[model samples]
Target: MRTTKLIWTIVGAVTVVLLLAGVGIVAALRGGDDEPDPQAAPGPGAASALPAPPSATSPAPSPGADITGPLDLLVIGVDTRVSIPDWQPHADAIMVMHINEDLKSGYIYSLPRDLRVDVPAFDANGYGGGRRKLTEAMSSGAKVRGTDKADVAQGYELLAKTISDYTGVDGFDAGAILTFDGLSRLTDALGGVTLKIDQKVVSQHRRPDGTARKLRPGGGGYTGPQATYLPGTRTLTGWQAIDYARQRYTAGGDYTRQRHQRQLVRALLTKAMGAGLPADLTRAEAVLTALGDTLVVSGDRNAIEYAYALRDLDPSRLTLVGLPGDSVINNGRYIGEQLTPVGRGFLKAAAAGTPEAYLADHPKLINK
Candidate 1:
């Protein structure tokens, strides 16, 4: 009897061990099936052992028409002020951006703020007739019409009509204008850009208490105010780079400022396509959102296609042209001188994508 009992006890122990082993195997299998492989889902927080699916859609790239045709973009920058009612938002900058679809080259035609032109009436006979600064079109419309929104829209329309009338670019549509605001946001989106400062520039900021806050100069010059100086070719944070671009009061004044703005844009493009920078999906999303608000992209598919074709463009091929200096006339009164006939011709060529022909016709305005 004792031997039989001992044998049964041993058998029971063996059964228990087998049961545990079976349970362990089942658990292992379930865990394997439940946990997804980290390598398979590499998205945000995936590196931290968290499983996340990558975003399905990327931001729509700039649009274009033919991959090898000439494209023109009208870029407008508005300067907003709190005071002066609704008409205070005026276009401080205007640029005709031309892209060579085939060569992947680009150029910016900067229109002078003081360029004189026939100011179109936004409303019916609000002002009988007048010639004024090109920049005043928006403000005049807003102030005179007493409807800021309508005036702003009319302002853009007038500008488009003027370009079309002068250049004869058949499709110079009013809807092609692209506008943006808040330089800080733009700079932040680009991570940081490199800028080459040809000369030393200093800008002073005024404090609320009437004290002057002077930014100290730094070596290599400075990309932004933090460094206080950005010299030749160096990398700069977004804010710093924006400051450089917006430095209008520098010794070189508006001309230098416009050139810097172009340079800053090129730098941003370079960094965007470069290596070493982390793939910042969040920042990219923010940028897209901001652009949506700031840019008034035309609905034209051709314009969209042209933007896409510029993806592989070389920055060096991009040229910058200031409005002809001689075309500017200060009458010492309200009326400003008109854009030079050569300058107007350049605009015509740019709009038509025949810059070479335009240059041949007006050699004097071409940058040597």
Candidate 2:
């Protein structure tokens, strides 16, 4: 799901598009033949308070290690200008999905962009030390690394490391990075999606003095006219959905924005799961050709295989897990957030393959 953004918000959309638009990517692949194994990891109350979540039954894989059975994917969405050639990207969202070998049910955990973290320094900048925001780890890592695709790769390198180090699960079995515009393009490729809205909100387009810049009242959006999101279910075009998910001026601010992004992905997943992409090679290739070079997915081939499996996965079996925390001022000046010990435990539970157990203790954290 998103950049400065709908953090961890776009995977559902990616799942929807790639499964439908890029046939060769998924058609030749198959879900793992392993049987579904949902043995409970240590319950939250029984677990020790480690720096991060302990691994599931099997030992955790080291960073970048490929493992059989259950898989954990660190999904990243970044803001980038890939066409510019020189415009490297920065992560807008960071989300992790953990699934059992059976590929039946999975947990999606969204880490906040402004959540304070201990960011490691790059060779160019040296060690950052002290506490920093989790969002800066990648940009800081890229600064020290090379400027070519190497830079983006370094960013992810640091990103995956930082997240794993913080969460304390074995390192990710696979990971993926997406440019921000990929959301809009992919959503458009899927036609449009219907999103469920809790409270109403208007698009976040304002002039210097904070006056409304758009008033088209629904339908097309982003580059041109758009409308306020009324409470209820509404069908949104690619841009309209993007605009709706991008809005942060409403009550919940970025949190609400994150929520909307998840809703958008859910809608897209609904569409993707309903499609017969495997049977429509011609249409898939056409869709991919139409959106040439707009989306760049890099890192972890295993992650792509997971996408292949996602084409047939049930959307209802997936759940979004939000990190609960209060906004705070870090180092007195920087805006950041932190979770309570139990909240961190919930995160640990999610990472450790026991979200259902953690949610049993903290039901409020579950997506309503």
**All candidates' lDDT scores?**
0.49, 0.61
Worst 10 residues of 2 by lDDT: 1-10
Give the number of the best model, judged by TM-score: 2
User: How do the residues 175-214 of candidate 1 rate in per-residue lDDT, one tens digit apiece?
Assistant: 3222222454555555556677777766444332323455
Backbone clashes for every candidate come to 18, 5
Question: What RMSD value applies to candidate 2?
Answer: 14.5
* Per-prediction TM-score to the true structure, in the order listed: 0.62, 0.72
lDDT of 2 by residue, 37-104 (tens): 44534456664653444446673333222323465767777766556765546676677767666555
Model 1 sits at a Cα RMSD from the real structure of 22.1
Q: What's model 2's lDDT at 81?
A: 51
Query: Distance (Å) between predicted and true CA of 165, model 1?
Result: 3.4
